[model samples]
Target: MLVGSPKVRMPPGPRGPAALNTLRLVQRPVESMIGWRRRYGDIFTVRLLVFGTGVYVSDLDEIKAMFTGDQSSLRAGEANAPLAPVLGSRSVLILDGPEHLRQRRLLLPPFQGSAVERFREVIAEVAEAEVARWSVGDRFRMRDRMRELTFEVIVRAVFGVTDPARIERLRSALVAVIDSQAVLLVPGALRRDLGGVGPWAAFQRRKRAADALLYEEIEHRRRDDDLGERSDVLSLLLRARDEDGRPLSDAELRDELMTLLLAGHETTATSLAFAFDLLPRHPRVLARLRDELAGGGADYLGAVVSETMRIRPVLDAAERTLTEPRTVCGWDLPAGIRVYPAILAVQHRPDLYPEPGRFRPERFLAEDPPPYAWIPFGGGIRRCIGAALAQAEMAEVIRTVVERVDLEPVRPEPEPVVIRGITMVPRHGTPVRVARITG
Candidate 1:
């Protein structure tokens, strides 16, 4: 399904087998990308395992151009078709142009700074309760703890599910689907159900269970007499009407809810895991953050979160396929080829952030990187809808954990990066031993 053009002037890249390039890229994405950027310079191309001819741009000027290109021509939804199986076709993640804009408008109100700020209390309460259960000297994976905390926040704030029994049931069902998603990334030839005996079949079963719980919640909320009085995301979305005074369909509601649950539950938790991994290894940075938290300052805490995201971004790149032939980053790109802003490569540019490999939250405190240079949440009109909410959750979780307890890395070296579903996560889950309970 790759869109190709005979007249296309493709950027220079490895002339070898696409499968081999994809194999190394899949095994070690960050290192492979860094090597490609060094070898091929600012802009280059790679043919994925199955996806064809992806051009990667790391320069700020080109990145800006690609992000701000003509909206109609840049078909991110088509490029994101792989997600449709899990997220559903109606999801905001897989829609393009006008339909995408419509979903964004209806969903934007609840994710605003003002709206997300309201969840701080809920996030904090969840954080405190979660850390409270952490034994003083026990070694544990911060990723595991963070996932539990994030999932509970989604259940309470996003779904407004308060009943202990119902929350547990919903959480269990959702995690089942999330855990088996690696089955979706393989070649189409290998994705068959095989009489309900394969990973795909198993994944389908989990997806159905999760969908049933979600649909139940949607219908149950629709019948609630006091829905209008609630401010939970699900409630607000339920009350939302488009310009035509039309409410979202049941499928729309379910897909959007699933998208949000996946974003907040996976991306934010993984970012926090990376933060925990970095802080214990960098004593100076850790000390400065503890001081800022102790003094009740906000700027440094915000900077810490920004630096964490910039250094080890969860999602690798924001993708789009061209519907028509268009010039991008000074290259005569053909329609159907995917163009990536190369989020990881751009952020690690040595010129943009001196000593890019170091974990220095102070750099963010002192100065801002160039606009296109530090895009972890992405840019343009298509930026991630949950950006503000994700950062707020990260801040509150980090604040609560640092204030209540001290953590020490279980290993001398920080955990290496590994792919988990779509996000880059700490390989060892950032194992740590709770050093002390300060608060």
Candidate 2:
């Protein structure tokens, strides 16, 4: 417990001019965060147009407290309201307390143990097939290709949809929905449709098209007698029942499925994009990674994934809203205050990671990072359920790419990181050339 004078107030932070701060964040999220941390120490507050006032904490102890604190007092779901337009109000990302736990319990089995291994095989197959489509000496956007691969992997592995036409329909709809997500950053934009001409209206149109397909699939699957024996996430979810033996409703199923599709594919694809972007810049690291893949050593591959996540985490922070007043790191916070665990800042702390900007997979090989020091997947009960699957997919894809093809950066300089919806992605989509077909 942090002891302090009773008069101690909230941590130092930027005041007023919320629009300017929000613009700064929108334009350069990672740089703005680092600047504020340097100027204001471990904990600071920033006012934003969409989220109002938010306190960002980079202190490891404070972050742990926020993650492990009483569930009744901290609500991560509420903090995720901005995503509700796409994920739906009933999604696991928007539900809190007992409801969140129940949904989490129902969703856990499909992402763990043997289930993840099965997903890994599906990911490998998808990567190999996608790689086969890439011609040697062709220049392409790595992130776009990665997104297509990850999207297909999740659709097949999670949804169990095998029809090419159906898959294409879902793919088109999902892409449109994802591409239009920027409207979410604009307050009240999602609420006003503006007669089908505005961004919000366009998004709604795409969402409805996607929802129809998802619902059709769900209804069809519910009638299948063999659902119980299937291993995909949708199958498992359809068969799940709560303590009272009640199955999830169709609406519940739709929201959860959408959540998995978006969260599962988007972040993993971005992580791979960053990995590809970084590897070409460091020949020694790339050589070591290739050697590890060729020699069938998985540890180095895992380390590379870990290192990529540490350096370029897709989501800048994990957030929770306070339900009651609490003292964190000697700062008295009021109820309803939003607190952000600055994952990006914490992972880059010089004391925790020397020369943090350098891409060094060996740092992970040296020893495990301290608890909460390297939390790309956040932490505690709200930690990303897809963490294991994401890591596995990244390793398998990296290995497949390195074994089958040689790659080089399309430009001399590294791509800039830019904010896309809630994620940080390479501005130029990580352009690279397929130098040759190695195998």
lDDT of 1: 0.85
- Candidate 2 deviant stretches above 4 angstroms: 1-8, 14-16, 183-202
Q: Model 2: which residue pairs collide?
A: none
Steric collisions counted per model: 1, 0
Candidate 2 local lDDT, 250-327, one digit each (tens): 998999989998898989999999999998799899899888777878899999999999999998889888888888
- In Å, residue 96's CA in model 1 sits off its true spot by 1.4
Q: TM-score of every model?
A: 0.93, 0.92
Worst 10 residues of 1 by lDDT: 1-10
lDDT for each of the candidates? 0.85, 0.87
Q: Residue 158 of model 2: what lDDT? A: 87
**Model 2's lDDT to the true fold?**
0.87
